[model samples]
Target: MVKMGTFFGMSLGAFVFWQSMDKVHVWIALHQDEKKEREEREMEVRRVREELMQQAQQRDSVA
Candidate 1:
């Protein structure tokens, strides 16, 4: 009877631990995705700014 009780307790603890870990993993993945998206947006903005500057220089040269 004591062995059975011990087994039950251990199983319950393991289950709870696994559930919490799963939630943490999901949260970390979501944060990483957001970070990647932000980086991509910043890169695009930089590219656009460079292109605009080049166009302005071309116009100035023509005048």
Candidate 2:
């Protein structure tokens, strides 16, 4: 009877651990995707700023 209870307890613990690990993996994936999007937006802003600076320089040279 003790052996049967031990087996049942181990099985339950293993199932709970598996579920928690699966959630952690999903959270990591979502975090990575958000990081990628943020980097892309920053790059776009830098590009636009450079273009504006170039245009202003050209206007000043003409004046």
Candidate 3:
């Protein structure tokens, strides 16, 4: 009887541990995706700013 109880307890603990780890893995994955998106957006903004600056410089030279 005691052995059965121990087995049950160990099984429950393992299940809970795996579930928590799965959640952590999912959270990390989501954060990584968000970070990638943010970096891409920043790069796009920088490109736009560079283009605008170039245009301004050209106009100044022409004037």
lDDT of 1 by residue, 1-63 (tens): 999999999999999999999999999999999999999999999999999999999999999
Q: Which stretches of candidate 3 lie over 4 Å from their true place?
A: none
lDDT of 3 by residue, 1-63 (tens): 999999999999999999999999999999999999999999999999999999999999999
Tell me each candidate's TM-score.
Answer: 0.85, 0.92, 0.96
Q: Give the TM-score of candidate 3.
A: 0.96
Answer with 1 or 3, whichever has the higher TM-score.
3
RMSD of 1: 1.2
Alpha-carbon local distance difference test for all models: 1.00, 1.00, 1.00
Count: clashes, candidate 2: 0
Position 63, candidate 2: lDDT: 100
The best candidate in terms of TM-score: 3
lDDT of 3: 1.00
